[model samples]
Target: MPSTDRRHDIDALRALAFALLILYHVGMYYVAAWPWHLKSAHPASWLQWPMLALNIWRMDLVFLLSGVAFALLARRAPPLRLLGRRAWRLLVPLVFGMWVVVAWQAYAEAVTRGAVAPGPGAFVLRYWAMGPWPEGAFSGSAFGITWNHLWYLPYLFAYTAAMCLLLPLWRHPAGQRLRAACCALRGWWMLLLPALPLAAYGLLLAPRFPATHDLLHDGYLHPLYFTVFAYGFLLGTDAGAWAELMRLRRRALVLALVALAAYMAARSLAPDWSEARQALRALYAWSALAAILGFGHRWLNRPWPWLAWANESVYPWYVLHQTLIVATAFMLAPLHLGPAAEPLLLLAATLLGCWLLTDGLIRRVPWLRPLFGLKFRRPATATPAPVRPAAEPIPR
Candidate 1:
């Protein structure tokens, strides 16, 4: 759906945001007071501050970018066909990952926690057979299967399908007015407009239904993610919206810094949720998103060779990264490597494994490609040195 004119900025942002996820997940292995598949022996309380900064808007940015991709695809295919392509591209990976790839993460968690007696080799068979293991340490513990970190695909696909169902309304009068309003947002309004839906969700639904990421019952996340996805669709399709973001980019950054600072200060006073805290939380979340979008549009628009490959590889990397993190950490944690060496080794192992597995194997091999959400055919070469052709099929 990315036109002949590529938005390398989106590609850059997507790549960078995901890169941030890798670092943050590494932090998750060590961040204090957080429950995860595996935890470091020495958890650092200080990590909470920086982790919160990235945590609020990282996934939202991905959802927003996905909506942008959807808008581009909407121009090329009918809603039904687009939905079909997304299912083929996304659902296959989600299902394949759940059945085959993600099982390792679950096994690592259960074994690390002493919830399961056996090693991953034996547990994989039991897991494949749908036996719920003991202590329920893995994600989706009650069920025999779990997507683990790959929960985004199902949620994104459902949102895309829902948007397709409403395709007719996208160009209707009210929808046009809505788009116009978004494109017209300027200065402070541009900075704050997208936050309203998210704010409403945070204030209302988030308390009642906490984020389980289970896909079926996460009420709070639906409204917020769907709204951001819709925001991406509308704004990405509107040229004026790009111009507006450019104009407000600096302002958005300033607002983001101030809001984040205030959010931090409020955390010091009373970290628990209240109506005022919810509103501030929403404001902080949305501002961070705006800053990223505005900055990406302003500075990241130019085409670059590495970025094109990074863009195409984003989905596969997302599918593969966290599992590698958990597995790598699990293996290294026993070495008494200390905080410094353990994380360093874990990150190195994760990166090496992902590169070898994703680029060396998955990208080149035809049959295994679609299983990880990659196009079946690619230049047999490593990411093409020349950028333009590579950028065409996959939108930045």
Candidate 2:
């Protein structure tokens, strides 16, 4: 494939990844042992099994896809220009999301925990002012504010800016050589070598720092995410690498499953066996990603009718989904809906809210676009086709 050609597979993978994230957040509500902003009336311990499988690799896949998106965009614009655009697209939504889009989530959590009385008016006033409220008021109450799920935006923006700053080195001969070596890996090297660094991070940093998701304090995640992000940029347009991934899809899937089983077994059999489990976790993470990308390339690389709409709507939906999930759960809590009816209604309501608010309101309003990480509409005008074709559109 040409460097400029649209990678429909990547687009589909990214959309599917975000969709999985939404589902995972919904699962968070009902997972008995895990902590979320809010919980369902009926938390299922069995959820831990499936949630563990997904939790290992889901965000890594998302970050890698983001790196791929960055590589695609970098081809079209100068580093400085790209940096400016990324900052606008990421930061604007982050600020807006923290203050406005995520306000309901924080409020719901506080009310549910008895941290605050239920009053949207008063809560909004206090939240907007960045309250120094009673301890345990919300997730990030210690910092006087919280971004919740919107943490991804700022982290992505930081990574983008860092990559942009490093563009000069990335374009240099040494960088190209490094990129070439990464893309040239084959078979077992491709499968296992990429995971060593992840294992190292898990063993070295995770014990001390943990995943706080507070940006500045996230020692382990910064390295892990940045490394995978760099991996995506290196392999994004490499046809040979993608071909290898597709060829290895089945083997990778098998390996991922085996790794997951081993990791879980180790945890159950010997809870203190940290080193082996971490290695297994890293192995599972990379293998699962490879299988996902490979299968996506083979099957999802198409221009489906709904893809265009999905591509555009995904950002707003991501911003809106968790809030809807939280608020819906809160509203339904009073009625004492059973587990079966409650989660079903929560899922339906969340999806409906995302559709109604995003398509019905946000997309139509010009001013609201940037606040949700969408581009402003350009006036329709005739223009000549350029020598280089536009790249595939990836979710921000």
Candidate 3:
């Protein structure tokens, strides 16, 4: 059975995951041989190593946490009510984000690429009109619009709806038995069994679909993400599963590190070994996740002064971070600041923007709350009542 006690570790892990995402986007600007909306004048070849390490599993971790969050919320409300609330929370921001928050990113990309004339006013008019643009106008000009970094919102909302539709079966005795069997896995079984499906997906589906991130066409990612999401949901309240994670935390870390080293060596030394590399990548991804969960549960389960604030602020930070990075980079590129100073300035500007906009403007304005994935503040004049715990917001 699910515990009534709060999962502080899960909350902390989610916050940290989003924080890592912010850093990753900043790195994207400097990482060499990768396409980003904007790129630094002097790209660092070495940056790709760390970026690739993170790219393998960061979004997977986010989806897993989303499923864990959904499991918690599902325990508190009826399926229909939960589905309605999720749709409102997810879709509202997605619409608002694509139109308002994400517009700057698209405009910046088009302007940088010289695909469109450099005028914010004209671009906004054309963008909002949803008409075709010249080839190479922006990241998704072929589609007439782009969600950019906010793609996770619609994907998550879809998964939530699917799960809700299957709620009855999930609650059935057969489903419960299957979940229990998964949770009861221990030792090597815990590590190896979960990775088989991921490897299978990598071997079979990855080459065919190739991860467009455009909800409808992403065949490989849908199964991969949904599988991990289901893993999280199944393990959410399983004490035995968590205990096994904690017990294997050290070994998992070592395995993850070794796998990473082997994978990188293979990529550099024997690029033709596609099947072996794929299997190793899957192994490393799962091991890294297991190690992270184990360490987080061991050390982060207690409430800290910052936890409450982070839980509230992470969603807004996520929605705002990528645009800030792209915009800051766009503005800074012409200055000829040295590589070190330029990226540092960009990072500083992005963090300051997220903090200022999220705290000073978004949180303070009641009407602006829902658009950024926050609940409205209670009116000061209302009668006092016990505070109910808010459902966890899905991380972007």
Report the error of model 2 at residue 257, Å: 0.6
For each candidate in the order shown, give its overall lDDT on alpha carbons: 0.84, 0.91, 0.91
Shift of residue 248 alpha carbon in model 3, Å: 1.0
Predicted candidate 1 versus true structure: per-residue lDDT over 1-396, tens digit per residue = 235566777779889988889998989999999988889998999999999887888888889988887887888898888899999998999999998889888888888778887666789988888886675768887887899888899999999999999988977899778678777877788777677777788888988998989889999998888888988888776777787787777777788788788778777887764766677777888887777887788788887779867966877888899989988887787788887888788889888888888878888888888999887885566665665665578657
Off by over 4 Å in 3: 1-4, 379-396
Could you give the C-alpha RMSD of every candidate to the true structure, in order shown?
5.8, 6.2, 6.4
Instruction: Indicate the TM-score of model 2.
Output: 0.94
Pairs of residues clashing in candidate 3: none
Q: Where does candidate 2 stray beyond 4 Å?
A: 1-4, 378-396
lDDT of 1 at 342: 81
Q: Per-residue lDDT tens digits of candidate 3, residues 245-359?
A: 9889998899999999999999999999999899999999999999999898888888868999999999999999999999999999989899889988999999999999998
Per-residue CA lDDT of model 2 for 352-383, tens digit only, reads: 89999989988888889889988997446798
- Where model 1 places Cα greater than 4 Å from the true spot, the runs are 1-4, 271-273, 378-396
Question: Order of all candidates by lDDT, from best down to worst?
Answer: 2, 3, 1
Clashing pairs in 1: none
Q: Give each model's clash number.
A: 0, 0, 0
